[model samples]
Target: MTHYFSWLKNPDNRLKLLILAFVITLFPFVAVSFFAFPTTDDYCHTLAVKEMGYWGYQVHYWKTWSGRYIGTLISATQPLAYDSYLGYKLAPIVLILLYVHASLKFAGAITGDKLAKWQTYLLAFLLVFVLIAELPVVSGYFYWYTGYYYTVADIGTLYLLAYLFRNYSKLSSRNIVVLALGIILLVGMNEYTLVWLVVLSGALFFFGSVVTRKLQVKYLVLSAVALVFGVLSVTAPGNAARAESGLYPTPLKYNLLFSIKNSLAWQIHNFAKIAPALCVLALVLIPIACQLFKNKGDFKFLRAHPALSILVFVGCLYLSYFPSYWSIAEPPNLRGQCVITFWTLIGWTYNVFVLTFWALEKGYMKPVEPGKPVAWVVGLYFFFLFTGNFNYRSAWSDLLTGRAARFNKEMHERTALVLNTREEQVYVPKLKNVPYTILIVNDETDPAWASVEVNNGCAEWFFKKKFFYK
Candidate 1:
């Protein structure tokens, strides 16, 4: 344990560890993309966007924009939603690429090393693992393209924190102001993300002193400015109205152990059928032990560094209390307390505990040759986490172009039908330009779609009443 603690102090080794951390982060998304879209959330959000196209927003932006805006302006200006599903699909890719680039840079900052060509390959593999851990959720989101924005928001916060940490020493007045501005922008874009962003930011301020004893007054001022700006942005009338348009005032639980258990269980259940061996090793048994025994800090470190303890405590508290939200107000609830806990704890165990300790205990205290076997061992460890899984590959391909196009085509035809239009357009909430537009269009192609029928009164009659359009 002493050896490991000693190893963490070495800046060079810390760089390698940072590279290792990124691999852990990226691999899960890559692996899961092969199985399913991240979640139906992406499609659902797209539906909202489609609704925006078909009708104007009801309460929040009622006077500002309507569905006509979507058809006329948005489609023309942004490639995100255009004439076809392909355009909609490619829209989120740009944000995701930005996220990936930001994350890579962030990882490099923490590791304090340039990612070599070989390291970059490993980085890709690691992304696969990160995506896998996320599993079906990532692929499910990939289908509609919009879901990626939610994820990008989440990951973007982490990258921003990494940026702050990496540039902790060299933060100038300009840099601090820019970071403050960035936080403000992020808050306006996504409130839930801002909540986690603040939590992470607080964690950095706490853990930072542990790594670097240099605490500058400027850093404190900058953080304060950022927090204030973030609050203002989030509280902006427009942003708040948007948030209220969705559900709110949900409670959050901070029970770490329980949340971790729940997260592990869900991941296992989601992936066990697809990748049993990997699931058993990574999600089920190994992580259990890793969380249970290995993460415990020794007396010297734990006792001496009361600040670290407090940071962990406060972070856990914030994480527990934070309400889980999605991109849309009526967004599908994926905010499992346990899932968040597992992700948080894993980062703790890997980056904060394992990698940090390994660096300190080994020759990290003194500069060692770059060819250390430990680096190789770390590389292999991440490789296994990323590769050796194949479920999501099929799932992703199925969603990308096929499903969206099919739905749009069917919807177009159904809306074209008089019976469909009368049934769907009746008594439904009207949008701006596309008032009384058909809500759902179905056909004989699938019994499911065929079973849905509507009448002149907009009364949706499902086959055997199995489903309701409303």
Candidate 2:
């Protein structure tokens, strides 16, 4: 074991091993994607876009449902819009690849060429793996076309952040245009990410001006662009229409207070649920973070005002939650929660890295050397993650138990049945095996359930006949 650990210490060898592990970890998710089927909102969005031209669909959604201009455009162009089931199956695979690519770019940019390529890849892989494995709702973000706009917006945000971090010292005209376009598109994508961009851009401006004592005009410009788009998105007539349809109808003051309270509560709840896994992740990250810190310059702002840094981290969490609560007087839905989980994981890891560097700089703790124990910890973490994590386990289970294939067959059969049936209302057999990782919400015998009703309506619109489960 000592010899094995020593061999693994070679950077090239480690990189190869990590790559192998990533492929192994990713295979089940990708394999199962081929068997995944759209449900609920996926059908609804596809049917709407099919009925309306792309531009008309966008305008209709803006007037009645959402002001997410970019999101509406994305939904309108989903693979189902063209009746391409192959494209639907491939969407998750494309998204997962893009997500990892964005993560690598962001990780490399933030590290500023200080760490070796292997170290950067390791960091990116860990972040991507953890976020994917522990999502609050895997199908919502990964398999469902309706919710993928959030993922695309997140990828765009990462690329934008990478550009800013890589070019912080100077900004050319081209950079300014790119920044403006990125901010507009991101803020227009969805309210959840719009609020995130607002908070992040505001922080950049504030920290550059006051904390770091260096005023970066780029941050100010970015903030201004984000705010302008934010206003356009928030003030859309559809926003009020949607709000009125929300289950909770509180006054503005009460809503604000409740949002704040719920924000705190939800983050705490999420943290508590994932605390054990976080500890293991922290262990795996400590040695890597220590090495990254060695070549990177001091964390001057974080070191000088640690309390403020911590406060800002917590504040960002609150702001992320506020949009959901304010919009509906409730916590974010599963899809929104998945984005929150991603941000929280990234933010928490950054805090840990910063704190570790601070402790070492202050001589408050000894530097943790990487060796046999680190290798064992990493191996164990991956082992348990594959075996225990809900997403991975569920993916493997769906594939191994034939649930994924069965679900696909049933859905295709339903499609065929709908196409052939001439009756005003088509009754299809209920799904016998629902794949947990592929289908977010399945239909029921009764079409009166809210989600089922939406699905049935979409089917009716698409096939020109009502749908029901026998």
lDDT of each: 0.40, 0.77
Kindly provide the TM-score of model 2 when superposed on the true structure, using C-alpha atoms. Answer: 0.91
lDDT of 2 by residue, 305-411 (tens): 45555777788777777777777777788888887777777667767777777777777887786676776787687778778888888888998998899988988
| Model 2 backbone overlap count | 0
Please state the error at residue 386 of candidate 2 in Å.
2.2
| Per-model C-alpha RMSD | 11.7, 2.9
My TM-score estimates for the predictions, one after another, are 0.52, 0.91
Span of ten consecutive residues with least summed lDDT in model 1: 431-440
- Residue 333 of model 2, lDDT score: 84
lDDT tens readout by residue for model 1, 226-329: 56655654444554454444335433233445455554444344334434323322322222222322323321222224345445544543433333222221
Find the 10 residues in a row with the least total lDDT in model 2.
443-452
